[model samples]
Each structure stands twice: as C-alpha cells, then as structure tokens.
Target: EEEHTSCEIPRDAIDVCGVQDPDDVSLDNVKEVLDSIKVLFEEDKTIKAYRLWKKLEGLVGQYEEAPQEQELSDKLMNAKELITESMFMLNQVTMEAESVFALLEELDSEEGWELAKDEAGIRTWFKQPEGSPTYHIKIQGTIKSPIFDVLALVNEVDLYQKWIPTCDLSKAVLNISKFKRMIQLCMTPPSPVNWVVSRRELMLYGYGVDMMEDNKMIAMAKSPSPGE
Candidate 1:
C-alpha cells in the first residue's frame, strides 16, 4: 500500500490527520527574504531563518484551547493581566539576525558567503539560545516554497485542524479590517483524548500592532463586543 500523505486528506475532514514530524524538516537555507531585509542593508540567510522560525514557534502557543471555566479564564487573565505573552524570543532573534548580517557585510564578499551556514540541519544563522520555557521550542523554517501558502489558510477553517493542534471550530464573527475580527473557537486535543471541551473564545485580532515578520505577527489589540 502507498503511504498516506497529507495531500490525501479529504476536504471537510474534521480531525487533524497528522502532526508534522520535526525531524523531517530542514531549517537551513531559510528562504532568503531579500525584498525587505536586503533593502534595509545586508543580512545573513541563517539569521533570517532564526527570526522567522521563532515567530512561527510563537504561533503554536496561540493554538491553545480556551480555559475550561469562566472563573478559570478570569483568574488566569487577571493573574497574568493578559491572555498571552508577547513573543520576546522572536524579537531577540530578529535583532540577532540583523547583527550577524552586519558582521557578514563588513567581512569580504568571500567572507560573507563563508560565514553563511548552508548545512542541512542548521540554517545560515538561526541559533537556539540556552534557557527555560523557550528551549523546548524548535524552529523549522522554509524559504520561498509553495508549501507555506499561509495567506490562503487564514480564513480557511478546515485547514486549521490540519496545522493547529487544538482547534475544534473557528467561526469568524467579523473580518472587517484585520483588527476587527471576533472569532469563536473550541478545544480538540490529540487523541487518546478525542472529546470536546466546554471552553470557548471570542477574541479580537490585528489592532494595537504593526506589521511584522512578513505579516505572521498577530497582536490582539481590541476586545470584541458580546454578540460579535
């Protein structure tokens, strides 16, 4: 029998068919984002990968299901004063990438290419910092591949189950202006535990933020109305 690849999954299939294996991914040679970065100055290909990967890793956390009880949500939000933490690690990588790129440019043309990492497992400059809470994360990057197509996936609810692990349903109450969206979501964790959870979210997005990281950055800057 032929191996069942992801492309084989039928449309409207509710369950997430497979989780991407980290080992099968290659982060090196991250798609060199020459348009924006190159315009600013020069940068290494690896550092670009590093910044982008960290940003992507940050999204995995955004996929978390809402808390079970209203009380729990209140307690959690009140305690933390927010639903999620801003991605500091990702910003750090961006700065680091910029630094390395500057270093590479100063060296001879031969040296810049020499300094660039072109290995399979490691990208040109993305680095994993040592520490807690962040070390568990890994960056798997791609460059200019037709594979990402994240833009098309934005409003495609069916595809969420394919990539986001905990999304049961995502109903868009509004999409007028990116910041004005109100979305409802439910929890659907991986099985051995294939049951729905009671918690729901009607969060807003795109306000109180500027465009960042090729537009993958999502900052919730507003609260939705009760009905919205």
Candidate 2:
C-alpha cells in the first residue's frame, strides 16, 4: 500500500464563499482622506462629501471580513464619521452660496425685462427667455409698512392667502431652519380665467436674511433644484 499524504492549500490560493484573500484587501484609507480633503477646495462640497461618503461606506462593507486590519477598519470608520459631520456643516455653506447666486441672478441686470403693466403705483415687467414657453415676471411696488412688519408678513406662510389676492393656497411643506423653509403655493386666476385655467401650484425654497445693521432685510424665494 502507498503512503497517503495530506496537503494544505495556501489561504491566498483559496477562493471559497466569496471571501477575499488577506493580501488582496486594500482599504486605502489615506487616499480616501486625501480625496475628501480635496473635495473641500472644490465647488459644491456638500455634494462631493456625500458622494465620497457613499463610496467609503461601500468599501467598509466590502472589507468587513478583511483579516488583520482592525486599525485600517477603525480609521475608515472614523473617516466616515468625520465626513458625516462635514456634510452637515457644508449644507449650511451650500445654502448660503445658493442664496448669493440667486441674488446675483435676479439683480444682475434690467436689460431683459420689458414693461408689461404700470398702474396704481405698481409696475410689472415680463421677460421671455429664448426657447422657454413660460415667461419670467417681476412685480415692483413700495409698501408703506415698516420693513420688519413686511418681513413678518412674508414669513407667515399660513396667512399668505389672506393678504395676497391671487394666492388661494399657501403652506409650509418643510422647515429647514428658523430662517429657511420650503413652501407650496397655489395661485387662482381671476374669475373668467379661473373658470378655464387650473390653479398654478408652485414649490418654492424660501429664506430670510436679516441685516439689522444695514436696517434692511431680504427675503428670497426660488424654485428648488431636485437634489434639495
């Protein structure tokens, strides 16, 4: 009878049950940290951080069973936590940036708007951008009420229908912070028009900036992007 011999396969050579070789596991935590820091210098840090966090989170799952790399796993987890905190802080920065850009877009020029109506101390201007069926309208008027009072009236979303003749439905959909919220408004057309045209519903992102030192307050509203 020939002597029987047993041979053990090297762990690296085994490919059972989708388990990765210890040598093949590459967390690259340092590279991820560097990439996250690079995102800080780029535009839209909130979005960038979110994407990176998702990527790292996937990696964490992929290497969950990795061998002898507890330190690297801990570092990756720490990195993910840090990115989450950064995301919250970056969200505020993004909101401020959006506000600044919206202000610039609205106040950049008067060249495109054409006078549509002027009566009773109120002026209305309309601008139809190329290729867009809808028109951009601007209404200008002076309110005799104090600035703070006007600000309060605007911030009170539930009472919009009581004050604005055209608005029939107004409500706050989401409150982001003390000074910012998402609002929904429905405008009812005049008698003859209302009979034919459906109510126009608008989803707006609104925020207020108090400039007490300048004795001025600015409240801005615009359509929110899908991501928000």
lDDT of each: 0.38, 0.62
On the 0 to 100 scale, the lDDT of residue 51 in model 1 is 41
What does the lDDT come to for candidate 2? 0.62
Across 150-225, the per-residue lDDT of candidate 1 in tens digits comes to: 5456656445556666766766656644333456566655655555544445454322222244443332323443
> Any runs in candidate 2 off by more than 4 Å, and if so which?
1-85, 118-121, 211-216
Clashes by residue pair, model 2: none
Model 1's lDDT to the true fold? 0.38
Candidate 1 stretches greater than 4 Å from native: 1-140, 143-148, 178-180, 193-228
Candidate 1, residue 155: Cα displacement in angstroms equals: 3.8
Q: What's the TM for model 1? A: 0.28
